[model samples]
Target: MAKNKNGSGFSRRKFLKGVGVGTGALSAGLLSPAETLSHAGGALAFGTPQGPGAVPITLHINGQAHRLSVEPRVTLLDALRMDLEITGAKRVCDRGTCGACSMLLDGKVIYGCSMLAIDAQGHEITTVEGLSHNGRPHPLMTAFVAHDGQQCGFCTPGFIVASKAFLDRTPHPTREQVNHGLGGNLCRCGTYHGIREAVLDVGNPTGKAKTGGQAHGAL
Candidate 1:
């Protein structure tokens, strides 16, 4: 009975060893020839060759095509400022909360920092630098200057870009609408009143002109 017990134990150990070998061989065999080659190539490639960097992208900015090579992780703001030298979009906060990096994507307002350069491809992107035409400033830009809407001027570009978008959609927005629309931008110099007046001036330039003319006539 002891001999039988010893024999059973030996058989069990042998069976376990066999199972282990069989599993390893089965796993190796399960991988197809193409898969094995690919795995080997991947390892060797990583060891010997450097991976490709910075994919090529074509961006339609302000009615012009700009060809650029940029990394996948680069934001639209970085690509625009660093690569393309278009620095109108400020890099304040570097987060989507502040509208400092605001720009027009397909005629719609979007934060440049929040959007990936790859995603901006194949779309028309309008930056603050591009808002002007024929060396003339945009109406919103002109109004901002006329109304003294900016202070330190760091946040001016973003405000102007956002205002352009707002005016495009609602050309005749009320003072309350301008305030609400521009609430996303923060002014450190307490220039909210001027900004609001600038937006209002864009919508009601005739009124401003008439008032100015009457003031001059009275004087």
Candidate 2:
């Protein structure tokens, strides 16, 4: 037992040597701060590390379930169009500002480009391809065609999906409301007039009147 100058049992040199030995043990992987802390806190097991490769994701699209292996960084738009072959959601501005990649996530409108594919799993995703059923077109689709709402058609699918979401929520919206609701989608053909008319047409459709066995369009 070494004695210090002040009569302490342990000398400063002994304390320094113990510190050096502890540091050497720590550097050599014999002692880990994390393990020591975890033991002190009564934690027994360390979590398993994530495996390599893409993660398994389950996407509910258009009422159908699709299992895919996608990277953590894959965008929802890419997953829908490229991997899943559901090209209804267009990729115009890869960024979220364009809204051309708009789709229904759990019945709510969201920009697919902005959302991660992994995050969209387990949510009901509706694309333009899933809008029509049993060969019958959706009301908005019919209205779009009837009113010539689409011109270039590059942005048609996105507009139709976005419009469907809006009209489903508000069947009879005013012009201001329609404009505000559809503010997310952009059309390069500048066919806003027809789009507005189409939305209104669906909201208020004139029925034929029967008089004396003759059919006449209702006023």
Candidate 3:
């Protein structure tokens, strides 16, 4: 029953206790939507129009259409590898730097890991596994094997996909052009010699060296 100097009934200890209760109530009112939903035993809706559960999406991959339920936040690479079971696109350096997750979207090379699956709708996605026809290897794939362009083989799929897209545009690229074109991709095995040889062989179809490309790996 301690009293203040002013002889008021409201003691400092009582004021402090009231302040703590008020702060707790204020904090409860300011809970995030997700926290509120969880406390109320409700689910949160994702994407626009706000509905529960994953969004339904359609993907056109390798001349085939597939329907899948995926979260809007899922990346195209994750959708391809986890949902579609297309494991050819490697998930290395997923920040779009290493190019190990490169794939063709609408016939243009794109970083699969950096693209959202929801954003890939209405476009043709081509992975390295799609380059073959009826179990027949692509010409670039054939050349890669012949020239021993891959070692450890993790980055080969992305390199092949990117190379195929480049070759499609520039049928006869110089070694410098090839080096610049494939600059985004990195091979830890130091297979630039073999990869340059493979592309040159495909472009020329005869053994003839044009330019010596600097041996450098993508970061």
Which residue pairs of candidate 2 clash?
none
The local lDDT score (0 to 100) that residue 10 gets in candidate 1 is 50
Q: Write the per-residue lDDT of candidate 1 for residues 1-219, one digit (tens) a residue.
A: 112365554544335535764222222224455644443312211234321455455577888876665666779998786666577898998888778899999998889999888668768999998988899998888888888988898889999999989888777666667777887777788887788878877876665422431221111
- In angstroms, the error of model 3 at 29 is 42
> Candidate 3 residues 101-169, lDDT tens each?
999999999999999887788789999989999999999999999999999988999999999988888
My TM-score estimates for the predictions, one after another, are: 0.70, 0.70, 0.73
- Per-residue lDDT of candidate 2, residues 1-219 (tens digit): 245667767765447656764222211123344543443422223364322445555677988866665666779998776566577788999887777898998788899999988777657999988899997999888889988998988888888888889878876666666788899989888998888778767765652121122323222
Cα lDDT, all candidates:
0.73, 0.72, 0.78
Among all windows of ten consecutive residues in candidate 3, which has the lowest summed lDDT? 22-31
Candidate closer to the true structure by lDDT (higher is better), 2 or 3: 3
Better of 1 and 3 by lDDT: 3
Whole-model alpha-carbon lDDT for candidate 3 = 0.78
Q: How far out, in Å, is residue 113 in model 1?
A: 0.2
Error of 3 at 8 (Å): 84
Best by lDDT: 3
